[model samples]
Structures are given as C-alpha cells and as structure tokens.
Target: MRKLALSDEILLKIEKPARYIGNEVNSVIKDKSKVDIRFVMCFPDVYEIGMSHLGIQILYDMFNRREDVWCERVYSPWIDLDKIMREEKLPLFALESQDPIKEFDFLGITIQYEMCYTNILQILDLSGMALKACERKEEDPIVIGGGPCTYNPEPLAEFFDLFYIGEGETVYDELLDTYKENRKAGGTKKDFLEKAAGIEGIYVPSLYTVTYKEDGTIDTFAPSSSHAPAVIKKQVVMDVTDTYYPESPVVPFIKATQDRVVLEIQRGCIRGCRFCQAGMIYRPTRERNVEKLKAYARNMLKSTGHEEISLSSLSSSDYSQLEELVTFLIEEFKEKGINISLPSLRIDAFSLDVMGKVQDIRKSSLTFAPEAGSQRMRNVINKGLTEEDIINGAGQAFEGGWSKVKLYFMLGLPTETKEDMKEIAVLADKVARRYYEIPKEQRNGKCQITASSSFFIPKPFTPFQWARMYTNEEYIARAAIVKHAFQDQLNRKSLKYNWHDAEVTVLEGVFARGDRRTGKVIEEAYRLGCLYDSWTETFDNDKWMQAFENTGIDIGFYNLRERSLDEKFPWDFIDTGVTKEFLIQEWKRAMNGEVTPNCRQRCSGCGVAKWKGGVCVESKN
Candidate 1:
C-alpha cells in the first residue's frame, strides 16, 4: 500500500488536497529498493498548470520506461498549501512514492517560461534543498533544468547543477548510464558531473566561466574544465517518428488547464517568424509519421479515457499529412463522441472546412494572429500574412457561421511607430466589417471582434534578440493609442481591445536576455516573498523592483538598449545549429521589411541543413 505524504489534518486545511495526493490513473509506481535511480520531475508551477505541459509528460513516460529508474512527479505548491507546509515543517515530496525530493538521485525541472524563475527557488526552498547549487551537500539531488527557457540558462545557472540543452529524447540515456556507472565506481558528485558534461547537449555551468566587458557585454565565455566543451551543441532528435511519446500519461485527479490527450504531430516550424524563439531554435522542422500519430491518439484516448485529443505542433497547417490524419480521426472516433482539437492552424479555406466538422460554430470563435498590424510590419516579422488574408479568412468564418472572432497582435515590436500601433485597431475594424458584409437576415446576429495585444520581449536566439524593449509606461502608451483608435473606428461597438500587463512584460524581457548577474536579483526577489510571479493576482511589481535595487542590477542594461551586431550575447556559447551569420542576415532583412520564404518554398541556408534530415532534406529531395 502506498502511503500519503500529507496528514489528514493538513490535507483538509488545503484548498485542493487532490493535488498533493498520488495514485492518479496510469501513474507509475515501483519498489524504492529495486530501482537504481530515483528521479523527481518538476514543472515548478501549480498542479493544474504543470499537468497540462506535454513536455514533462513525454519525459516522465520516457524516464520511467527504464527498469532501473523510478520517475516521480512534483509541482510547486500553491500559496495556501505552501504556507501550511512551512508552518508544519513538512518537506516537499514527490507524488508517486510520497518521498522527499531531497532523497532522489535527480531533480529535473522543465522551465517553459521566464516568469517561473522565482517559483524555481520556491521549489528548492520547500524541498529542504539549497537554493544555490554551490551550497548543496554531497547527498543532495543533482538539479537539472531543461525546456525552451534553458537556451538562456545564465540567469538560473547558479540554481541549476546542470542544464540539458535541446531535446531530452536524444542523449538522456547516456547521461543516466554515466551517472549509474560513476556511482558504482564510488565517484564523487563533481566527478559524475564532469563525465556528464562530456556528453552532447549537457551544460554544467559550474565548469564554465563568464567574463564581462566594461560595457557589461560578455567579453568571454569559456570552460574551465577539459570535460566541459566550450561550445555545447544542441541535441536534435532527427527521427522524431521513432522517438518515445507518452501514450498512457498520468491523468490528474482534478481538472487541468488542458484536460485532453495531446498528440504532437511535429517538432519545429517551417515559417521563420523573426520574433519567435521556438521557430528559430527548433530549426529544420521534423514531422512524425501520420500512421504512428493515429495509433498514439487511439492508444492515448483509450489509456486515459480522455474525451478530447489535441494535435500539438508549432504550426499544424505545415504538417504535410494533416488532412489525411484529421479525416482518419473523424471517421474513427467521431461516432464515439471524441473531440478533435487542432491548434496552431493557419486561417484558410481548408482549415475552416476542417474546423467546421469538429467544432460547434455557435459556441466556437475563430482566432487569427496577425502578429503585426500593417502589411509592412507583417513583412518585417516575416508573418507572411496580409490585410487581404485577414479580411478573407474572417469573411469565410462568418459565412461558415462563426459570429465571434478573436484577433491577436503584439505591441513594442522592433521599429514600431504610432501608425503601426493604431493599425491594430484598423485591422480589427476591418475584420469586423467583413462579418457585417453579410445580409442581416443571413447573419448569426452582431459579430463580436475582441482584439488582444501583448508587449514583445527580445528573446535569445531569435532574429529580434538584439531588439530594444520599451519601458512599462511606454508599452501602456502604445496600448492607449490602439484603444483610442478603436473608439474612432466606424464599428467601435462591435470591437473590443485588451492588452497584457506592461509590468510583467518588462520583467520578462529582463529575464529572457539576462546573464549570470541577474541570478542575484532573482534570489533577492524570492527572499522578498515573490512566488508565482506569472499569476496576475500574486505578481507584485514593487517587490521585483526592490529586488533589482537590492542587487544593484539595472533593468535598463538588459532590456532598454539595442545590441550591436558584433556584441557577444551570453547565449553565444550554446550552438543551436542556426548560425549567427544567418541570424544577422535575417535581422538585416527584417530591417528592410523583406519577407523570407518558408522552408517549403526555398532554402535560405540558415545552417540547419547540416543535420541532413527533416524539412531541409525534404526540400533538397
């Protein structure tokens, strides 16, 4: 029988006790004495939000497949439970075995976004582990970080013992095998880390050193140990179809943010959006076999008893076999009342037709992400979308019986102007007008056009990595301009506009491109009671500002200045296969408002071809 970590009294005091209890459907459990390694995987957020992440699920399923390894799961406790645990002096424990995280061999945290930095500290603090990796004892778990945010791991470098760069499916087996061998040979923790550093995609920050120039730019970034490579190459799983995927994922006891079986049809994106980090880092887009995806979908739905399945990809429209897959799913499961969700699809005739079959038009809303407002701005971002595209897509959706439309745009993009800001409203008004073009008798009543905008941050590895970010006041000003423009429009009654918090945007910008020096500010902020900074109700900007002041870190140095082409970025040492020269060329093209063709159109020589697979090879063939 499995023991519960929290007492009945403690569980009753919490809001959702189900989050702390284990024994979810399909969750793996093994005898502790039999396993050679005890691994605890964390998302560093609440249970519901963490459960929705597909990356953790895939890795969890992959890790637990090994007979010698028992992988458990943990999440950052919510504020209500966090306080109770601290008051009760209870250490944070994993869900599967109800064992303290400190007893595990490895603590792997998947960092999906920048706002969760403080929560990472919270996890370490609550788990009875040292916040900094350097302060940890020999018996402490080896803390490793992964996911998209690890591309710029310098900010969290002090907190993580090692960072697994790129895809986890590629070299994790080698890392675990080396750890087991080292432990059997009575090797020290540092010895194991040195061996792990030699493997591809493994980055041990303690073995590396960074020197800053007088201008605060990185003067040098090199490895101190022979085992640590100066340039850590990102690991890419060339054949994604053959890789491990979670068919029987652990179902949560309570409802999650995304309560459905997720089917990742592809990895990477062919469309090179200048502002998108995922598009840049995950180059040479790779697709899974359609037959395999269909098998996984059927198996996943059956294993978890989920009523819905969502196709996961950066861009679903780019998948070559999307039509066949969707058709097969509808024919196979539509009668069984299984819902098919297709996100990241480009708005087009085929997309509308496919969506109409699965979605109830009366309850559903059509979403279009123009990214930028004007044609020139769209070209600058390489969005490949135009005014004609937006109006036509909306018109088709309205005709197809979708009365509500959601438009997404970005503020404070590179070279943004007042006219560009106002064009956001103009674009929404144009979309609303397209819906009104239909006869009143044929319409599904007045159309609702809700346009939402978020301030852009200069993320590492993107063409806009060197772009300048605006202050909170400046971002709010841009939003105000767009709001005023909406009021001046002819169809103002039908259009509504909302913008993201400017304060959070500025802080996110700081962390996205920050170096090792920014770690101190994070520590200070966590000390000053900053947890769940991503949540709107919990985020206190004043505490973050105080952290910066206490640490003597200038947010302007990280976000305000436009970086030079020759400037050495903190993330330059991490080779992502996409060459710097190629990024520079794309940045110049963006400045000229030129649109780069997608991978299917032509090869622009972005340096990902060295892999000799995926879209790169497909284009050549």
Candidate 2:
C-alpha cells in the first residue's frame, strides 16, 4: 500500500466527504515509530451512521487514552463509493491517516445487528482481506467483533478470529495489556487469540467445534481446549458512574441514526419484556450518578454545540434517579441554550413528568410501545402493561399538552388472534379520545396519533425463542382486521396507521434467528443487489425470496415454523448470561398467561447475577 493523497476530484465522488476527511477535534493520530499497536475500529456501515454510534466513540477514546495503542476509524463505503474504489483499484483505508486497514495490527468491528452480517463480508472484501478467519495468514490483521449481536456469533463464527462477549470496558483493558506484552515478545496472532480466550469475556471461536444434527440444528458444541469454558461469562460494568466515556461525542454534520449528543444515563433494562432481545441481553441496569450525568451533559453541550441532548438508555424513565438527573440537566443547561430529549420512555404517567420538564421548549411527539393491543395479549407476551396503563398514559400526555402521540406495537406475537388484532384499533381509538377530553384553551392542537405495528420476529435468548412468526397471509389478514376496525371509528379520524412490510419482516425473522445454512440467503441476496437491507430502498423481498428458493431452503422453516422445546436452537451455545432454564420458565409462564415478578422485585436468577458478582440490581443500603 502506498501513502494516499486526498484529492478534491475524488472527494467530490464519494458520499459524505466529511467521513473520509477525518479532522475531528479529538481524533487520534499516532507516530508509527512510537505506537506499538494500531487498531482499525471498523464499523461495517457508512461513516455518517457509524460515527453516530457511541460504542465506537467509547472504545476509540478508551484505547487512544493509552500512549502505546492508536485506534482509527473505518466504515464500509456506500455502493457508489465502493464502485469508484473498485474502478480506482483502491483498498480499504482508515480515515485518520489514509493508511490501508491491513497496516493495522488489530481490526475490531462491532456486530450491532444481524443485518450487518453481509456488510461485514462486504467490508472485508473491500478491505482486500480474507472473508474467512482461517484463510488469513499471520500477516493479516487479527479481526474481532463485539456488541449485542456477538451474543449469537455462531452464524458469523467463521468470519472473526475472536469476539468480546459482553461489556468491552471491563476486560478490554486486560486484553490490550496482554496483547502489548505478547506483541513485545513477538507473539503470533494465534498466540494472542489463544491467550485472549482465557480472559473472562473474550471468546475465541476457533477453539470450539459446532456439530449440527440432521435437522440442521446444533447437536453439540464441544470445546477442543480446556481454555474454553462451558459457559462463557458476559462482562458487566456494575458501576457505570465511574466508567470512561466521552462527554463530548463527535457531532456529525449530516443527520444520522442519532446525530445529536447522546448522554447514556444508564445501561440495560429490568422490565423483561419477553419478546425484547435487548432487555434480556443488556441485563442488570446501571445508571450514571445524577451529578456526574449532569456534568457530562453540560460539558457535551458546550463542546458539541448540539441543540438537543438526548438522555439515552434502554428505558430512560426506569432509572431510579431520572427525575433528579433530568431536573438537574434542565436547570443547569437551560440558561446555556440546551434542550433535553429522552430517546426511550416507559408508558407511565409518572414517566411523563420527566418529559414534562422539557415539554415547553422541546415539544416532540410522544412515543410509547404498548407492544400488544388487548390485555390478555399483553399478558401472554409479558409486556406487563395493561390497556388502562397505555390509555391513561396517553390521557396524561394529552392533558400535559402533547398534541401528537406515536404508539408502537407488533402484530405477529405468539398467541395472536383476529380478536386481539381488532383491539389494536380499539386501543388507538382510546388514545385518540383522550386528546378531545382536553380543554380547548389548554389543548395544544389537533391530536395526531400515529400507530405503527410491526411483524414479530422470534429472537434467541428471549422467552419467545421457540415461538413461530405469523405467515404472510396470516399477517395480511390480521392487518386487514385492525385496519378495517379503525377505518370507520369517529375518534380514529386523527389516527394514522403505519405497518411494517410483512415480506421484509418475514425475511428479517429468517435471518435474525436462522443458522449458518441461511447464510446462503444473505450471500445470494447481496449478490443479487440486496446491499443495505437495513434501509427500505435496498431491502428487496423478491431478491430474498429468490435467494431462499435458489438455496433450496424453505424460508418458512426459519421464520414461520415452530420449534419443540427439546430442539436445539441456532444460538443455544452462545451464552448471553441468561440460563436456558430461566428463559424456558418465562416462556412457560407467558404461555400460561402468568406474569412473573420483575428481576428487581425477586431474583429470577437470569445468570447476570453470577457475572455481575451478585444481584443484577444494586440494593439501596
């Protein structure tokens, strides 16, 4: 690889030129002579999107804090830029130095979602790197992955050398220290990976052999080395208040996933919504101290010059000290020309008070996930919210002067029926009625209720792991029932219904919970111009359908087929700190329409306890 020069002619061709031209305020640039290790922190997406991610920023800041290690950013080019690169015969390079990615000692990519799997392969191909871990020689970069999707890295096990199972903050330092020591002694990539596997949260996939049954399911997962543990523990940083994170995240020039400054007030949620993989995966909620959060927000507002600072968390309202934190940020930053926004909120009247603090200035639409329509349906799914809860939550919002509200729900949850589907309209109607009850003078405006219902995709490590999704016809029929029920209602005039494309949801379900066999669908889909399936424009259902047919596999087998309790799931081997028995118990309870107490009330022993040293939630002494 040669030293590259930035040309305006070339820059004009690429999308979001600011991405490649990396001259951010705090970006690291190292002298190759002094730096012992160079890490290309690659996110398999466009730069604008990846730069918006806080995890990349966190790890970038964490590793660069050390003098010996230098981490740089690399994101997959869009199709146009990718084509131009291929035409120009350009290899993938990091943003900061314009150096080829292969020059780096380590390549760490974040496996944030299953959809990005194809993009991983695309990124590797574009990088002039081997797509498979085994094909690469010692001269190649030692590729590793982390983040939530790594909990089910089996489908992508062959691609990466190693995976950081849980929170990277706790054990990432230990791995770095060991790597620095080993590399100083001229250790090989294999040597470093083998040693890294011994670390608590690091999982070296090469040491494990996955054998599948005739039914195309995992039969047994055997570890070749004693270093590989039967149950790999997930890392959890218990005290979030003390964690090293950026107060001033880089503010992107263009709109991205979340462009504004995001102050993550907490990590994880204890609500234990049965269908939510995030709730199960990111367990044992940890909140930053109120004072620390306020200080961070203030600093971020000053540094980034961002208009809105979103208090980010799995469930922002669930934080015990949310009121105090929000109030403090508002009081301190309001005079400084900063407005607060909450990304996620629980459906509670009390939760609305936190938003009430910023309502006058930051008048965004209210969003809530009732998850299901009917009370019985909600009980079966373990959403733990009654119809009354949502109805009242809406009432409070309307009374509090929020004119528009958005309701989120899923239509294809297990044990769903036409009657339950009809109730979705009823719930939307109820929410609409609450708006008219508001006094005319005090009322903000016409109540706009936007209800979005998506198809349910059963995911691993959730109580619905063994559940089956509704077929295309079933969903269409159910959707019709809901659509028609609300079409004629007087209160529903202000209600706007939006639904997820049933076909895409079906394909998403297949990939999300599918095994390596389904990888063929991904590869074929990408080959047939199915790049950026995450976006609506690039998501071609016909292409996926054709790929499934070409692969000689039934798409329904992965999406719509029910699994027996005895059958081995694709992600059964990958431990997410939650025991199978615990999930099974929850599943049984869900089927029986029994609501188990949340983890905070009683110990469900979801296996996060062992990893976090004791209970998931901290006891107030």
Pick the lDDT winner. 1
User: Per-residue error at 451 for model 2, in Å?
Assistant: 0.6
RMSD to true structure for each model, in Å: 1.1, 2.4
- TM-score, structure 1 vs. true: 0.99
Tens-digit per-residue lDDT, 1-621, candidate 1: 878999998899889999999899999989889999999999999999999999999999999999999999999999999998899899999999999999999999999999999999999999998999999999999999999999999999999999999999999999999999999999999999999999999999999999988988999899999999988888888889999999999999999999999999999898999999999898878899999999998899999999999999999999999999999999999999999999999999999999999999999998899998998899999999889988999999999999999999999998888999899999999888888899888798789999999999988998999899989999999999999999999999999999999999999999999999999999999999999999999999999999999999999999999999999988999889888998999999999999999888888888888643434644573
**lDDT per residue (tens digit) for residues 548-576 in model 2:** 88889787677767888888776665666
Off by over 4 Å in 2: 1-6, 347-350, 360-363, 610-613, 618-621
Runs in model 1 deviating more than 4 A are 611-615
Clash count per candidate: 0, 0
Q: Give each model's whole-structure lDDT.
A: 0.93, 0.80
